[model samples]
Target: MTTITTRTVEYPADGLTMTGHLALPAGVGRRPAVLVGPEGPGLSDVERRRADALAELGYVALAFDVHGGRYLDDIEEMLARCMPLLADPDRMRGIGHAALDVLCTEPRTDPGRIAAIGYGTGGAIALELGRDGVDLRAIGTVNALTTGRAGEAARIRCPVWAGVGSEDPIMPPAQRDAFTAEMQAAGVDWRLVVYGGALHAFHHPPVDQAVRPGVGHHPEHARRAWRDVVGLLAECLPVTQ
Candidate 1:
């Protein structure tokens, strides 16, 4: 097993004191970095574990925070806070840039080789960063096929990969089509993968029961999605030992 280190990092975002989790690989040299965005509620064990997994793959990973470290367990509260925030592209960019700034500040991070990936609302934030013209190596989103303002997606300089469950009511087929259309119209390199028979947030583990009506876990799809993103990182941003 590869030895890794983890720590808490405090940063500012969306007018709150945001706290994020950072994980680094075992060795000594600078490495490619990844920004891991959390779901709508906020940063939690799932994203932190993802950072650890990225570290195991020899990259520095930072799991960004939303809601200032608060995880909204109530569906109504989560929607009330995230829905409007997600609708605003500028606010999402603010959150993403704030975390990106922190990641770039780390000496261990190779600023030239960075990628962003997220789940749910976090996924929207990653896409926002791409649209805002950040020089990312890749953008990967799971369970978030959200579309952006029509002309802005042209700023994306890297290939984007989005995954969503076929049965996802939240991000249904129309939404996926719209997202892909926007990407194609902008001439951005992009790919979409629809996991069959899965529901919203299908990549999530079956640890939370307080989910929306159509949300459920498909462990197999979750593993496959992880492998897909890992493969993306390997292709776009390789770290040499």
Candidate 2:
């Protein structure tokens, strides 16, 4: 069995006590940390699986709750709930900063070996953290539905990797092209990988709900993305384990 210890973290933000899960790998020394932001499903089971998987790989992974306890049954409601947080740059930055503080303040975390990864709306949060100059070692995002603010990309000092599907209607190839150009122009070390036929929420497996459309699980793609994420983290963050 893999050695993993789970802890509950309370983030005091917006006067709300959001509950989050922190999984730590066993060791006596400080370890590289990854702050994972959950997707629109509102920190579903899959994200906990992701945190456990990362912990099994010998990293201290913290999956933070940005939506508090509010979960939406429909896509429209999820978007509506997340819009204000994303629109208000300060709130978006604050949310990510709070997660960072949790990770950095942890006794098992190596302050210098910190990174972040997010998906969908969480992807926007990851980008926001990078743009806010969080001193992260690396950053990763999946299907960034919302773009960062003006000049935010230029503020990112770490290597950034973005994975998106070519057939994603939410973020078309044209927009991906434009975003890639903007990153290049800003001199940010960035890369964009477009999966040939994958759609939005590609990382999440299909659920029993009948309301979700254009959502399907691609385990192969998910595995590939994990490899890329692990490689990026290892390259950027110090090997503290």
Clashing residue pairs in all predictions, respectively, total 0, 0
Cα RMSD, each candidate: 0.9, 1.7
| Cα lDDT of model 1 by residue, 92-196, tens digit | 999999999999998899999999999999999999999999999999999888888879999999999999999999898899989999999999999999999
lDDT by residue (tens digit), candidate 2, 1-241: 6788988888876556777789998776788899888886677667777888888878888888877755555778887878777777778788788878898898988888888998877778888888888888898888874566777778888998999876788788787977787788779999888776788877777554654556666788877877887788778874653
lDDT to native, each model = 0.93, 0.79
Model 1 lDDT at residue 94 = 99
Tell me the TM-score of each prediction against the true structure: 0.98, 0.93
Which candidate has the top score in lDDT? Answer: 1
Off by over 4 Å in 2: none
Evaluate model 2: give its lDDT.
0.79
